[model samples]
Target: MSYYDEIEIEDMTFDPKLQIYHYPCPCGDRFEISIGDMRDGEGVGVCPSCSLMIQKRGEASNSSCGYLNAGYFSSTISSATRDLIKTKQARHI
Candidate 1:
């Protein structure tokens, strides 16, 4: 298989409940990696149904779960992100 390409962590979505980071894969599946894995310096994201993978690149921070307490705002969520979050939440329900 060809080497996985590098993708910024900003391009991925974090599931606070699952504590996993996910990005869309070309194979109609998602590439997933964990916050713990990133903390342990494991940056490779793998697809469950395909040979594809990606290397996550970004500084590890306490706000990886998209929440911060006191004096820290990583980024604002757009309507699309809100919809995606709702969908994920619904699926988990």
Candidate 2:
């Protein structure tokens, strides 16, 4: 079975401003990703550690199922955003 088979995704709103797909991770962690940026059929992203392409199950539209493995940090993202992720990770542990 593929790793994608293990992920449970909900219908999520796409954000044009960020150009990414968002989903709640199985670990209770939320991740945002850019499907357009990934190699075709190879769900991959540029997040710190998690970098892979993730696809939702049984979704006809790619917009509903395709996503990068993790969220990326660009000039658009504020340092505060990174800090918040760090904080969340700390709390999760």
Candidate 3:
């Protein structure tokens, strides 16, 4: 029921296929939160097997950068972000 700590969004890994972001938990399981939950300003990442949680810090745009940097263009990342936003909106309806 209580959170262990606040984890930076930059420290988490974004799974484009799962549409979820995850960070390692101290309990050996991962702390997970969905991109949709993040977009809605939800900051809690929870470990499925435990009651522990972590507060996610930073913006979604900044976190969802697995495909960014290097030689890849910003547009591709932006497109993916747009798609994620659309998906989030669709789920609400």
Candidate 4:
């Protein structure tokens, strides 16, 4: 699975309400993935608006996001990042 770039987990934006991490995509959208999935051993944040995807590097547990004392977005990431690929078998919505 090729990605545009490898972004460190710390560089992604954490949305507490959705328990997800997001990063800006050049496609004029955002690449989003859920925090739970990250903790569950998932990587790759996909953009909702286009075919582009970004690979997540590092670990959520190592990130400084206070909400992640290690815990959980985008199956419905954000209005900007919703509907990204659900890498897991269990879909959030």
Candidate 5:
């Protein structure tokens, strides 16, 4: 299967609440893949607004359940991110 691009996991933004990682899509949508999908050995992130998809790479070690570790995101994410998540969650509710 071919992909529109190959992106590193570190480049994607992970949402702890949703357990999903997302990257920008030219279609004005985000390419997303859930942590469950990765743990199941699926690495493809799909854009909801288009047919384009990207391959996610860089899971060299288990993050406890076999995807990425919480620490990986922790180091990359700051408290501001948590606030953002909260704001998003509030809107969805």
Candidate 6:
């Protein structure tokens, strides 16, 4: 099965400073994303168990408001694959 099959997606609010996305997973794992190296529509993020690339739905908007600045305004992931991203990031770092 494709890696995508193990992941769940959703729309959510993002914070650049904290570099985290707050959401709950199907397996009861609450997680956050790192925005340090994110592009407008796609970026690498880390979770408790996994590391993965997150794709946002819409283009990034330029607004004076801090929250409206950049990153995926609405996004989500699955708990099962969440740790995969974290593992990837650890290797890079």
Which one is best on lDDT? 3
Off by over 4 Å in 3: 66-93
lDDT of 3 by residue, 4-86 (tens): 99888888888875768999988899999997687678899999988899998876664356343232334545777666655
The lDDT, on a scale of 0 to 1, for candidate 4 is 0.69
Per-residue CA lDDT of model 1 for 7-54, tens digit only, reads: 888888888656689999999999999866775678899999999999
lDDT by candidate, in order shown: 0.71, 0.44, 0.74, 0.69, 0.74, 0.39
Error of 2 at 14 (Å): 1.1
Decoy 3 TM-score against native? 0.67
Steric overlap count per candidate? 0, 4, 0, 4, 0, 14
Name every residue pair that clashes in candidate 4: 20-73, 34-73, 36-72, 74-77
TM-score for every candidate vs. truth? Answer: 0.65, 0.35, 0.67, 0.66, 0.65, 0.36
lDDT of 4 by residue, 1-93 (tens): 778999998888878887788999997899999866775677979899999888888765433364422333323345332223222222522
Tens-digit lDDT string for candidate 5 (14-50): 7766778899998889999886687567999999899
RMSD of each: 11.4, 14.1, 6.4, 9.5, 10.9, 13.2
Better of 1 and 6 by TM-score: 1
Most accurate candidate by TM-score? 3
Better of 2 and 6 by lDDT: 2
Q: Write the per-residue lDDT of candidate 2 for residues 41-69, one digit (tens) a residue.
A: 44432233354335553331433233221
State the lDDT at 38 in candidate 3.
Answer: 75
Cα-lDDT of candidate 6: 0.39
Q: For residue 75, what is the lDDT in candidate 1? A: 51
Q: Please provide the root mean square deviation of candidate 6 (C-alpha atoms, Å).
A: 13.2
